[model samples]
Target: MNNSLQTMYIEMVEKALDRYVSTQRCNNDHVLEAMRYSVLGGGKRIRALLVLNFNRILGGAANDAMEFAAAIEMMHAYSLIHDDLPCMDDDDLRRGKPSCHVAFGEAVALLAGDALQTLAFETLARNTSLEPAQVLQAVRELAAAAGSRGMVGGQTVDIEGTAQTVEQLTGMCMMKTGALIKCAVRLGCLSVGADEASMAQADIYADAIGLAFQIRDDILDVIGSTEELGKPVGSDAEQQKATFATVLGTERAQSLAEKLTRTALDALKQLNVAEDDPLYEMTVELCSRKK
Candidate 1:
């Protein structure tokens, strides 16, 4: 799986993220603490890895993508903070520690999310390595993904619990989870000015993996342990969330995830990356992730 390369990329992303959310940047000490707590809180960093690896694999300097990767991670972290708010999922645990709203007050956590989200765009707009047009394109991609018609739209539907059928939930999952995931690769393609065909392949790959990721998460929530997941398992069922696992039985869901993993790998055929590429490895890893 080229674990060492994966680790290096993850370290690069972590450093970039820390640099963006550093003490010198956040003026308010209290909010800074909350921002750091959530942004720096450990997770798989899969989204950032997707950004860097896709960029590098598509002929962009991985370094050029680092800031953008950090920006995406910031956005992801912000979403997590807001997702755990009292008005949202209202869970207490995140990454095995108290959620942002639990560790910090709800107000601070909310502000922390808001600040982190803005910082993401700032980081993108501030980058000098990429051309102005590329940066602007990246901004548009991120905005569309994070904005009301994308992730926010999916979240609104989920909160409303309006999705009953599998098709409806799958569509919602695409908006909520797939939007950012697809945007990560799209930014990678944009960073390198990859060809239209290449970008199209990457989007197809992202779509398959993104759905597999959420389906796997639904599976894990049912069968995984709190110690492994770093949060309470079975919370989806507890909340009566319409998950792939709930809509389809775990066996069927597992089968579907495997099928999607194959589809993701197949779409990457046109990217011309060898099977040994970290992108391929990570997609496979995600398919069987225990946490």
Candidate 2:
């Protein structure tokens, strides 16, 4: 059942993402090509899936949440493109393909990231299925999550706090990697008019899983193969980037990831949702994922 659900979810997200890129129009072919390339670059689309799952949990239609999901994905993609720049991580590859800066020039890649970031807001604002108020709220949530107060701020700390202690490093990872994830779930709840209590419950789940997600990522960087991960293995070590493996050691990091997954599952219990719910199972599987 989990396999079926995962396959279905991946298919749905892929179709939505494909449509999103194809529908976009730009004056410059180069800019358009870069944007499409960056977005079409394959990924797990976990953030978008989180949005969809929470939207369902909150009683919103999946279709109603589709635009917002796509928007969030665009924002995520933009971040990755910028993160892989020569001035940033200087990654040459992503998802088994050349990095955006490698596929296109650095200037075009930068423009593509910028375009995708702006397009995220545009997509959210243009979501006709949602009320104006809901759309506006989602936009505001995304702005905070993606902007200086959230992911960007976290990234700044990550770069500056490289030599910091484990606690500081964890805090940076939480902000940089977890903020947008929290926003994804929160926006889904808001879309369905969930009460404060329900939103808070969702927040607990998001917070735990968000941190777990990053911890697993750090683990993957150490142990996962490039073929399985679709990116260079041990890139963090190669770049001397501080990670959970670097500070806490691999065994403890793995244990922490398991603990966080339990925390996320426990938070979901407050929802009174079904045990057999696909979202619940997906959340569990995500933390335990090998790749």
Candidate 3:
């Protein structure tokens, strides 16, 4: 990520995310604590950035989009918590600390993930700045993206060993990762009631980066160090999960990522985006990410 992204995550997103998970607001102290811990544990926060930046670009205030942005991050955090469960990816390291199931008991972690997911919708609905229709639109899109038709669908496919080819893998990535990324873009646009043309162009940008981002993840899983990534590497290979690297080879996967990034940049250019926009820098950096 770039300096702007870091600053946004630290100065803006962190506070918004924290304000929602206070222990005083829940039933059991343990699940509430776990929810707080998991949500605050942290990551790149790329989804929230997509929401805020797209909103800002379309003449909406960043402050006005805070609830939507923060809600998406909560959704993302819940996904990570569930993904790291023993029955799922089975990882014991997350956000440079013990996995949710390790830091908290499995039952508590499961309930916590469930809680965060519901809380995400509540947070989205709590948005006071946006129109009711606008908020409804975002909520509808988010539910679809997070439900059986989208991210969870992708996870099911991944676990079921259905992605045997490059095309299948790409399709899976679209739902697993691209759905949220695309939804973030949509949420931003909806916040400001952006025109159809801009929304179309934004989708083009989102799709390219979304897949490109996954391609980079595949590359990193092969070559990234555990210390740098804050998680164990080679799990994909060990699990025999097919990836861009496995299907297309590392060199070709790298080439594909670069090509997809170019496509993303071209979409932004078509929209006449400013040259110094953080999105431009972020898109460029995604291809060369070391971790």
Q: TM-score: which candidate is best?
A: 1
Q: Between candidates 2 and 3, which one is better according to lDDT? A: 3
Better of 1 and 2 by TM-score: 1
lDDT of 2 at 112: 92
List candidate 2 stretches off by more than 4 Å.
none
Q: List the residue pairs that clash in candidate 1.
A: none
Which whole-number lDDT from 0 to 100 does residue 290 have in model 3?
Answer: 79
lDDT of 3 by residue, 114-167 (tens): 999999999999898888999999899899999987899999999998998989
Total backbone collisions, model 1? 0
Please list the residue runs of candidate 3 whose C-alpha ends up more than 4 Å from where it truly belongs after superposition.
none
Tell me the TM-score of each prediction against the true structure. Answer: 0.97, 0.94, 0.97
Per-model RMSD to reference? 1.2, 1.7, 1.3
lDDT of 2 by residue, 148-262 (tens): 8888989888667554677876688778889899988987887787899998899999889998999889988898898887778887887678888777888898899889888
**Clashing residue pairs found in predicted model 2:** none
